[model samples]
Target: MPTESFDERFTGPTLNQDLWVDHYLPQWSEPARSRARYDFTTDGLRLRIDADQMPWRDADGSFRVSNLQTGTFSGAVGTTRGTHRHRLDGLLVETPQVTRRLWTPSSGELEVVVSASADPTCMLAIWLVGFEESGPEDSGELCVTELFGDRIGPLSSTVRVGIKAHHDPRLTDDVRDIELPIDATKPHAYGVRWSGDGVDFTVDGQVIMSSPQQLAYEQQLMIDLFEFPATEQREPRNYPKTAMVHSVAGTSAS
Candidate 1:
């Protein structure tokens, strides 16, 4: 079994800067716009997306996010070098980011107790992605849990999990959504146990999905809350959508 590394309950008056960077991707977008709107509470960490918050990047349509991560790295400004370059044309770094790895793990078991508000216009996710400090091809993602409020029902919810092969030629996208018999608006345990051979995703101690292909590179954690603006068909919802993380724990073989 992997040895326990750290357990965070978020018992604090302020966020622990040593373990977290309270921004989504400040390099792609400016720090002021990418900055996370969150607070440390007695219950844990509360991440929020308020109505007044601007979109992460003006080029991306109608999406707003508040996120925290355990690491960040990017090339110098004016270069198209960063993690999760979603745009096909690529994005230039507005602000350069120095490499920082707080809790990156290569092979491990990681778990979190989390819950999100049931507003249909909002969603929450916890994922791990390659830091890509070594090479751009190292950028792959393992989504531990992704819950869109629209998928949440009273008795069950459809949660997305699996791997995303961004620039990594060694990986192929294998993400899928699975319906589970639990309300996602309430706190529940979500976990992943991984090694070089395979990865197992779990909910409340029960393995729900597994993949034979595993990503061997060290990955950093990302926790986020997202709010989608109302479109012509979708009606607007209230502001301040939130996601609460009760705890996070991890163990590593390294």
Candidate 2:
């Protein structure tokens, strides 16, 4: 296989007319302090934040450093079905709180958790902060490109998981609307893989979304999640959902 270069497309919240594609993370410089640990044996990640520690702001849309500290939620590891459910902690964005946590940025793995709240707009994502630098204006180099797709629903397209970059702190406006085709309602697993060429989203070890010639850096492993539309409830539906995480060992194909 031919080596793929870095891909840094932007499609979330664009600045001016920029498409705001996904950001690239060099393998050596990923954010490890933000990674979370998943109890694969239990099918969920260990949320460390307490219920009372949740922040007071709304954690929807784009998030910045200043607001990142003000948006989070918490709950105990409640019980459901015949097993223990994952107690949500930290910031809650959108409906079914789709969020990411890097247990060790230094490692090649990341945990992307999804909780399908009761709302219909499902918390498609929680928070995302990627790194990218644009070339001189008009230098014929638009480093970012928009992702294409829709929200998760009967009429929605398959959701694509990835990252983004922000040059400012205020996140009240729509940065951009880069949608991807990610089907989160099937009760299955999805993820993205990157190498020297580009980034790819996969489900059950099957590649789904491929971004060729769109790599921001080499050796960088980014993490992201997706949630479907639900009601106002913060808890996910009792449908035997699974929390899938990629091994950071870099030895196997996820």
Candidate 3:
């Protein structure tokens, strides 16, 4: 195991303010269509998405669901701190004018024991993103774990991992939907090790997907337990599906 860098076990009654920033946010800008549906319990960090919950309208005039990240970002529409652009490369990238704070990690291994929501309209994801002050080509992402609802089967579910190019020439927009041995809705440890030229993903210590591309830039951790209503159809199998995170631990050799 790599030497300990940063670890959060969610043992307290609330989230550690020093390690996390609530929402994607500055509340003045990207307000939710509704309110946060989370509980930081001794059992873990519980995140929920309710179909009946209405989204809160933002100043941008869009209603959004609950969202949060381990890092902080805020700025204007086109303002940048360093070299990153104010907009995306036609897809999703950082929004600079509204972004301010970012905490990038050194080389490390990040592991989280989590249970996903059963709703197909939602997904539970843990990933890494470039601070992107370096520019858009450097705005690649390492999706350590993305558990989508539609991908879940009766016995098991497929989790996608690896790099999402996002206009980065150095990355291969490659991702694999690897079938896990257990039901994703049950608590399981999903991990990613960033070593040399590869980012290996594992489930309960078993290697599932290995991406050959290792990003050398500074990256920050991001956690997403959200519902994309656009991804849903008919009535949900269940309402207010919650994603439970037992812990998020990071260790580094540096």
Off by over 4 Å in 2: 1-41, 46-53, 56-118, 121-158, 162-187, 214-254
lDDT (10s digit) by residue, model 3, range 35-147: 45677776788887665655443233323345555554434453343222224333222333334333465467888899887677778888777766566567677788999
Per-residue lDDT of candidate 1, residues 1-254 (tens digit): 21237798989788888888999988899877899998888789999887678888988877889998887888998888876776657578988998887887888999999997788888899898887777788888889999999999889999899999988998989999999989998999999999987999999989999999878887888888988867623323665678899998988765
**Residues 147-254, model 2: lDDT tens digits:** 121344443444434433222232122223334344444334444454446555555466545544333322223232223323333442332222322221222122
Ranking by TM-score: 1, 3, 2
Clashes of each: 0, 58, 13
Task: Find the number of clashing residue pairs for candidate 1.
Answer: 0
TM-score of 2: 0.34
Residue 119 lDDT, candidate 1, scale 0-100: 82
TM-score per candidate, chains pooled: 0.93, 0.34, 0.79
Q: Give the better candidate number (2 or 3) by TM-score.
A: 3
At residue 16, candidate 1 shows an lDDT of 83
**Which consecutive 10 residues in model 2 have the weakest lDDT in total?**
63-72
